[model samples]
Target chain A: MSLFHWLRKKLLFLTRANLFIAIGFMLLLAGWQVLSFYTHEILLASPAQAACALWGIIGTSYFNENFLITLWRLFFGIVSGGLIGFVLGTAAGLNEDIKNILEPFRWIMLSIPPVVVVVLAMLWFGMGSKMVAFITSVLVAPIVYVNTVKGIEMVDEKLVEMARLYKFGFVMRIKDVYTPAIIGPLGAAMVLITCMGARVVILAELMGANDGIGYALGVTRSNLDVPQLFAWVLVTLGIVSVFEFILLRPVEKHFIRWKL
Target chain B: MSPVISFENVVKEYGGRKVISGLSFQIHSREVVGLLGQSGMGKTTILKIIAGLEMPSDGDIKVIAERVGYVFQEPRLLPWRTALENVMLPMIALGMNKKQAGEKANHFLGEMELSEFTHYYPSQLSGGMMQRVSLARAFATEPEVLLLDEPFSALDLQMKDAILSMIEERLLVQPMTVLYVSHSQEEVMRISNRIFMMSSGSKLDELPIQHCRAFRAGCKKAFLKWTKQIGSN
Candidate 1:
């Protein structure tokens, strides 16, 4: 295709909303690099040191296993929590009795601090990947549930009436009405669950995990390996972003084409 | 012959209020019946009950067929879908292939004089145009009974007249059992074969349009006399 056509297609995808996200990230990166210059060299590694050191340590054996472990934990945790929460959320939305039963639990989940799930999981499930995964799942469930339920509540009642009048079956109703409305928040929830899952994995490692990025960050902190610690943080965050772009973005784009 | 649709001893209650109590009506085959009523007198509710959108609370309702196309009080087009796509939604909902559905929808749009606006979204259309698109969608499905709830009540006089003329021409060639709900007396005389005037939960009068037109204000012997008679009934 010609460059003109390519540019036009690119422009079609352009929106102020997503463009602002890119701009904000760039600004934050720049500010962090500039701030490093005025700070203590040991405490705050210069951007050059952080970048170079991070690159050098990218494939190092010390960081590789832990990072991979945390990644796996996050993926599984998010999937489990998101599925359960989605089911619960939809059921509660459809049935008043379910809503009455689950509303209190949902509120409790929302109000409690993140650490509470983490602490409780550690205590009950015992320390390891399993425990960390459990904590992450618990942390993510409510956010996904609440957003999905809210999306369901916003479906057009009149459209539903039209569906009934036509004798549209369950599959047809879902495809025509519910899918368009539900997918929006459901897509957002997936993104959130993924990020939150990563956080919980790291936090769980710090709390009790023997292997994962969190454990490495924890070890490096105690040993005053600030540069290495910063590198690990950067690498983990990079991994998260890469997965979101590669995996989640395409899925979100497919489902959210209606909004466009 | 049994009526095409019948509402027998219909008692419609909404949260302890008796909206339509012990009401009964019958519409025969190929007849266009106008439901003339004030707002919130349960005309839309009756349409819904017949459409099976809502089941009656206490009534014996008989609909001859399952195919019902409903035009809601408002045009409820999918904002995300184009005119053709919105019209094709019923076909798609019925499990028709997208390719076939689109072809059928395009045909209907052309028939409705909306071929140029097939790709336009509902938000882009004027209120009258939206109603036309909604009408096209309902008719596209080839429904057995087309239930219209004040479909053209939002249009300006010129636009409304043009639409009604189109409807009249179309009905001459291809007629469905139509239950057109409206408050406009002119619309009833123009389109309806039969008229049922709803008043305070009972029919003020149910008569042929040929007779009812004379009883209306403009051409009547005495407008005040007819209005007083209607008011007392």
Candidate 2:
């Protein structure tokens, strides 16, 4: 096909979802610009100012050190929490006694405030990355656990019977039946956890740690550098988007691509 | 002929309620048996017990087959797998590698007239098409015994007729002991070598059917009369 014709065909297949997403982003930027106009430069940085400040930090050693530290903490927190929650959730879902036993603990974990956990973790683990990682994992575990249990409960018994009749081994049964059964609910939970994990890690760092993005945000705040603060916020959001879109979304789609 | 499937004094109960009590029957080698029953008459329970999906509360159940293929009331297909992949599942579980299983799955899907829909997922297919995929999955295993529990209820007239003929053709090519459970008298009468009606108290009473491939109008009328008589009681 000619270049123009080929491009037209490809664009024809583009769904309205991307267009709507672009519109949403445009609206956000417009709102940010309007808000910045009404506030002092020291209070609210315009998008352009924030972009320029972000450009300034792009290759700085301070930015690299803090960004990598925060990224590692976020990574470790989510992985550890997700793994622990999946194992416990599967146990609780499969056995009534286990579910009953875990009920009060689940309630406590879900209901306890993030601030209280951060304070308690600070007391227990002291400051720095350890405290931040602990707080992130503590806040994230209940979300994944609850969703996993719900997903397991919703699994179709007919499909399980079919698997048994076909003599599916343990690994095949989990791969074919359980994993797909849980992926839908778990996908939504992962997105929630990703966004929440980013916020919690930054918050914990702000509260108890002397390093990472939250500490840098605190530094910019003390210096009255609103552009730098906004830049840090943008970088945090960017990190969340990268993990959500690049890592979690593709894995979830691979598992449940049969869905329309 | 030696019985391939024999259940002696089989009893099953769920939560203090008895579903099957002292049910005894024998299905000989290559004999296609049709089980007719109302909803919740333990017809499915009987099939489950034979397939080893459920245990009899009290009895000896023996199935000579090394493998058993089942088609449930619903398609019960893995929603994430395509039509071809769903059919390939049992063959792969039975130790056939991917390539061989894919070829066999293709052959069965072709037999069900689902060649074009091999890559279509369950959600993408219609109700009848999904059921056809389930049928293809069952037949692809080439099991020595096949259990079909109201598998055709979800299918329309044309699809049901085509599938019934496909089952008949498969039986002709390679005889396997089949227990076809359904509420449709015509369906049971069409394919069954021996027909059994679920009577009161979880018991089965053999009902004679006209042994003809064409299934004339008179035989259908007689079968309907018998069904009504049994149904009313």
Candidate 3:
């Protein structure tokens, strides 16, 4: 395909949903511009000023150091939480007794506020990356567990019976049936948990951590640099979006190609 | 020759309702037995019992076969697996290596005239094509006993004839003891050496076919005559 045609095809694939997202983004920008006109620059940064701030920080050592640290924390938190959740949830799905035992813990984890969990982590682990990672994982794990359980439970019984009739061993049944059955919901859950994990890690950093994008945001807040804080937020969003589109989306699509 | 399958006064019940009571029958090796019944008349229950998917509530049921192939009413192809992969599944389970299973599956798909569509997923295939794949999967295992439960009921008349012919041709070359279940009298008469009628009251009536001018000629003539008499009346 020609470059123009390829680009056009990609654009068309976005559908009406993309158009709505674009409109929402434009409205937010217009509102920010209006607010900046009415308020002091220190109080409300104009979209242009925030963009300029973003450009200023793009190549700086400060930006690179904080961005990398935050990315690392986010990655570790998501991976650890996701793996634990998948294992536990699959066990629960396979056995009613396990599900019953885990029910109370799942509920407790889900019900507790993220702020309280962060506070407890701060008290327990002290102020550092460990604390931030703990808080993020704790907050995200329950959601992953819930989604995994739902996914596994929703697998068709007829398929299971078919597998049994064919004398499929446990591993074969898991590979051919269970994995495909859960991939769709699990993919959606991973996307959700990752996004939530990113946000929570930043919150944890703001509360206690010494380095990362949230720390940078705190620094900007202390200096009354509204434009720079907004710039940091935008950068963080860009990183998360890159992770989602570049890594998760393709993996999800590959695993669930049967649905497509 | 000894009987390959024997159901000796088998009794089955579910939730206080008797589905099959005092059922007794024997299927000899290399024999094709057709089971005719209306819906919910325990014909499928009998197949399931023989397939070891369900148990009899009382009495004895024995099947002396190394492998049993079952073609259910609906083609239960794994939606994710392609036609060839679905066909290879039972072979792989039966201890065939991947390469050997793939080759065998390919051969069967070829026999069913589904060679070109072997890579197609179940969702991509039509109903008739899916059922053909299901048949190929069953036959690929080289099962000692084949159990079919209305395998072609979902197809059009032409598709049904095509599938039936495929099955008949395969059976002729490699005869296996078969317990074929269907609602159609004509179908049962055409395909089976002996026929058994089942009813909701747990009664089974046997009709033995006598060879005349051709295969199933006696049963076919009787079926045609019966249909004609009903039409005339």
Candidate 4:
């Protein structure tokens, strides 16, 4: 294909909703610029000032070190939680007795406040990244577990019956029938858990940790560095958006290509 | 020769509703037996019972065959699997190695005239094509007994004829006992050695097709008369 035509095709794939999102973000920047003009510089910095501050820290060792630490904690917590949740949820789906046993625990995990969990982790682990990781997993695992269980429950019963009649063993049935049925919902849950995990990790760090993005934010708050804080927040949002749209969306599309 | 399947006074009930009551029949080896019944007359239940997918509430049922192939009313191809994979499914499940199963599946798909569409997914195929793929899947296992539950009920006349011809050709090469279920008398009469008519809460009646084959015009007249009677009731 010609380069211009290829570019046009790619642009066409961007829906009107994406255009609206871009417009909305521009409006937010305009609003921020207006607020910064009205307010004291120390209280609310202008978007331009924040952008300059962001550039200053973009490649610095301080920013990179904190960002990498936070990223690592987020990844570890989500991966560990997602694995445990998927295994347990799938088991519950296959066996009614196991579902009954796990029902109360899932409910308890979902209902408990994340702040309380963080506090408990802090008390147990003595204020470190370990506690932050524990807090994030505790906060995110229940969402994954609940969604996975629901996904498995919603699988087509007729397909299961067909599998059984064809003498499909458990593994074959899972790979051929059950996995496809659940993958869509699990993909959706993974997206939710990743975003939620990032937020929870930052919150835990802000509360107690000495390192990472949350700690950096804590230091900026004490220093009354409004531009730096805004810069850090924007960077975090950019990372999450990249992870969600560029990475997870493509992976989800791959998993559900059969549907297309 | 022993019967391939026998149901001795089998009874099946669902939530106090008797779907099949005191049903007794024997399908002899290598015979194509058409089971004729109206909608919701428990014909499918009988097939399921024979396939061991459902158990009889009472009495004895015996299927002497080691392997049975079932073609459902709707083609139940796994949407995620391609036509070739769907055809290979049962053979692989029955412990055939992947290579042999692939060759067997390919041969059956060829017979069903689905060789060109082997890589297509179920969603990509037309209804007739999907049903043909389903037939290929059923025959790929090389079953001793084939149970067809209105397999052509959803197809148009031309598609139906094409499928019936394909099935007829397959049966000619390798004879197997078959229990063909359908609502049309003419369809059953065209293919079956014997026809069994079923009604709710009534004993099944068996009609041999040997004399009917000798007198084709007379058999058509009788089929029309029987259909009219059924319609009036």
Q: Considering only chain B, report the TM-score of each candidate against the true chain B.
A: 0.92, 0.92, 0.91, 0.93
Docking quality of model 2: it rates as: medium
| Candidate DockQ scores, in order | 0.41, 0.75, 0.55, 0.64
| A1-260 per-residue lDDT for model 4 (tens digits) | 97556655789865567667777999999999999999999999899999998999998999999899999898889888888888888888888899899999998999998889988998999777799888887777778788878888998876787787789888888788877888888888888988888888888989989889999999999999989998988878876887788988998888778789
TM-score of each: 0.85, 0.89, 0.90, 0.92
Q: lDDT by residue for model 2 over A77-105, one digit each (tens)?
A: 99988878887887887788999999999
Model 4 bad stretches (over 4 Å): A1-15, B214-218, B224-233
Tell me the tens digit of each residue's lDDT in model 1 across A177-226: 77677887888888878877787789888988788889888988898877
User: Who wins the lDDT comparison?
Assistant: 2
lDDT of 4 at A22: 73
- lDDT scores of the candidates, listed in order: 0.81, 0.89, 0.86, 0.86
Give the fraction of reference interface contacts each candidate recovers: 0.47, 0.91, 0.35, 0.47
TM-score of the second chain of model 3 compared to its true counterpart: 0.91
Model 1 over residues B130-202: C-alpha lDDT tens digits? Answer: 8888878887788878888888877789988987887787677778899999988788767887887787664
Complex DockQ, candidate 2: 0.75
Q: What's the TM for chain B in candidate 1?
A: 0.92
CAPRI-style quality class for the chain A–B interface of candidate 3: medium
Sliding window of 10 residues with minimal summed lDDT for model 3 chain A: A12-21
lDDT of 3 by residue, B24-99 (tens): 8899998989887778878988998888888899989889987888999999898889999999988898889999
- Candidate 2: C-alpha RMSD to true structure equals 3.9
Residue by residue across A81-181, what tens digits does model 3's lDDT show? 99889888888887899999999999999999899999999999999899998988888788888888888799888677667777888788878887788
Clashing pairs in 1: none
The interface root-mean-square deviation of each model, in the order shown, is 2.2, 0.8, 1.1, 1.0
